[model samples]
Target: MNATGSVSGAERVLLRLADEAIKMGDDVVLVSPSGPILQHIHPEVRHRECKPIGLNGLRSPVSILKYGASLLRAAIVLLPLMRSSNVLVINNTLASPLAFLFQKRLLWLLHDVLGNDLRGAIGKTASRFFRLVIPVSYAAANPLPTGTAVRVVLNGTPLRESKENFAREGTTSVIGCLAALTPWKGQKTLIKAVAELAGVDFRLEFAGSAFPGDEEYARELRVMAKESPVGEKIHFLGNVDPYMTLQSWDLMVLPSVAPEAMPLSLLEALSMGVPCIATNIGGSLEILRDINGDLVPPSQPHALAERIRELLNDEHRRMVLGEAGRDLVSTKYSLEERTKELYWVVAASTDMAGKVPPRR
Candidate 1:
């Protein structure tokens, strides 16, 4: 997995895949640009830190050249790791070419959409370079879609809650922003919506952390929260255990202002039987179907606030929508079924070699 490989959604997906693969008696090798996130890896999984490749530490032209050298270094180092693996699960599109080099079976599990803003994450120049190169690399990599483009794995959720009935009380409802505390994610927009509904009996919870080098943005979000009218009503629970966190909320909001490939948080919220109110953009719309919840236009705090009000006032509607969300996830995003389908896709296209198929 070449993702940032932290405790984020992508990491969660990778960890689950690695853990299950281990139980099924498959030897898993996790490769990252930096050293392995040893703390997060499954005990059975092997870790290798490939040289930092692609756009890391490459802002200036000189650094870009250095990073290119690093890419070559990574490719050289990863060759052996690639040769030993039968199935290669790639998280980011940028690293697809590296996996392609060794003829490794590719399961391009995408968590974010690739586009201008995503490219801009590294910087304008890096973004432009990626836009130029990634598409061709992705095309050549030839990855098969895994049943659903997005999968949500719900861990640490109480199975008993699945059978229990919870009371639907007041406008004192919860709107959860299940994303990293970054500007691009639009947690500020969710806070603004909460501010708009200040006098209304509703609360918003900001649940997630900033990425490795984004502490500054996280601080800004803290400031924004304090200034908002519903500041006290909005709680910043920085990166809680997702399954447990979703249990306490009635609603989930992604509100990503940037383009996204897929937002797994939507899937997590759905699986936990919580209704969502996401922006009408990217993978948000793809997951938050009309039957499950509302999808308002991006950056419009008013629209978000109004929708929250509607859902808060109507308990029956919320229950119906939440139940529908759970059902949709159960049928479409079940990990076992999706992973099995993905296994076939990898097995069919790549050389499985001496590895035996895991028992169903």
Candidate 2:
């Protein structure tokens, strides 16, 4: 289950997993409040809309009451069907509590480190109800209850052969940042770093929309870019298809101030043979551990600027890192490998013999 049908990183991972499951001849049903966004991607996966009654995660008394009602309603809807299934995989913490009614068949996939106290408490409480709690990264798994049955399954992406050889000798380098326009995403830091590189012949593109109520933050980033000395070189492409556009860039930058949990964009960049420079926090470290990319201190514009310049100046290093990143993704983060692991987890959790379908 997922909160929405929006094409965020988590949602993308769900769609990919569902696609792989269907390919393995398993019947897959995707439940969400929002309309099914995966229909175009995986036409065979069943879609069910259990419309949430009200906004989730609000702290107000009324919001809390509404959230509880929504959970109860969702539980009523899901409990009957889940009890008969061999295994049910929940994508996030919002719907984790519903698993209590049918905890025997439930597995919770913890996608984040729970940045808020209340949510963390709720997640910890819910962890007891799940048969297995799978985190996308070791960093995400560190905060869970000490004795809870836990597994770390790094998110995966489809590996694509890169077209570019990363040999930008004279042409202007294009650096792209693709993530939601939130404060912790650190787009402002990236803009500042770009401003510091005013003398360099490069262009910066910001390709993501702001979350609800964060439009002002997005506007603030655009204003900051406009006011910078290199304003003319910065472009706010607002939300473009990273898969189709990332290959055109010389490098990708993810300067997040907060701990990111296995960003799919980083994987996509690496799969496309694009060298990435990310902030040293959360899953970025895990993603870049064996790769040849660079990791700078989070929220440090000067360090980010220096690193960007260093990579831009060395074309050979960029090519080497890009190649290494592609190889890493192919070997470690491929969809087939992750799907196989997930299938085994389900089979093991359910105590089923050879229930894992043969790979296509």
Candidate 3:
């Protein structure tokens, strides 16, 4: 795990997976390049901390070599750790760089939809060791080679305990985008969209922390929000409780420019009967389309803004959409079922099936 402070959907899923594994009587050791993530580790799980590969370094010619050495050091530290493992579950292609040291005993729980660029090429190349590649969504699987070992395992969100009331009276309807503040997550696009909503009586909340080394972009977002005409209505709520957070909003938005494997925020929001509008891309498209939820074109703040206005005005439609989403969540995305399926897959795929029993 290339772990960090900002607990986005991926981090939440990782922690949840670990908790589930341990609950099922498996000994789970979370090994990672140390960061604020270590602070949030469960007491039940053994966290083996290692030095971070300085991928967060300043741009320089020698920086590459320095980081390369750092990566090597981290890999070496983790090699012995992996050798003892029965089934090594790696989230995304994060551990791919370390694959050369111990290639065989790895199960890639793939999450990224890398493009046809150099990074993507490298990610694909590393798939030579992916004895089992389980993508959280079909969109994530689409980018990989046709014959590559790919299994589509859509992320399952636990149902919200509290019922939502979309008809709550409010002079200022709150529009929120709950995701890690990053370039690809499209917080910028959301800000731009909200900026255009000057006539709309709405409060926009950007509820997430920036990535470890990406504070500059977070600063940029604050500046952008400050400069907008409705700047006072826009608030930056850093790392609030996602489940509790979704309950307060009249509408939720995920305006990601790039493809996510599957964002848990969307799932959580929808599960709670909150009306959501996400960009028509990757897993978001598949999810929203299935529930007949609203979606706008990626990077088109104008379209997003328009959709936001339309949804906020139509209370009945918003209620219906919310209900539909919640229904889908209840019927299909049960967390216990998904976790069991994951264990079954892991057990069935590897020779260490006996070691990785479906339950402890």
Q: Judged by lDDT, which candidate is best?
A: 2
Q: Rate the local accuracy (lDDT) of all candidates.
A: 0.62, 0.80, 0.77
Q: Which window of 10 residues has the lowest lDDT sum in candidate 3? A: 1-10
Winner on TM-score between 1 and 2 is 2
**In model 2, where is the ten-residue run with the lowest total lDDT?**
49-58
Residue-by-residue lDDT tens digits, candidate 1, 278-328? 887666666665464688888888898888888888778777877887777
What RMSD does model 1 have?
5.8
TM-score of model number 3: 0.92
What are the models' TM-scores? 0.79, 0.90, 0.92
lDDT of 2 by residue, 211-269 (tens): 65578898898899889999999998877878777868899999999887788889999
Candidate 2 error regions (>4 Å): 36-38, 52-57, 165-170, 351-360
- Residue 62, model 2, lDDT: 85
In the predicted model 2, the residue pairs found to clash are none
Give Cα distance to truth, residue 122, candidate 1, Å: 12
Tell how far residue 342 is off in model 1, in angstroms: 2.0
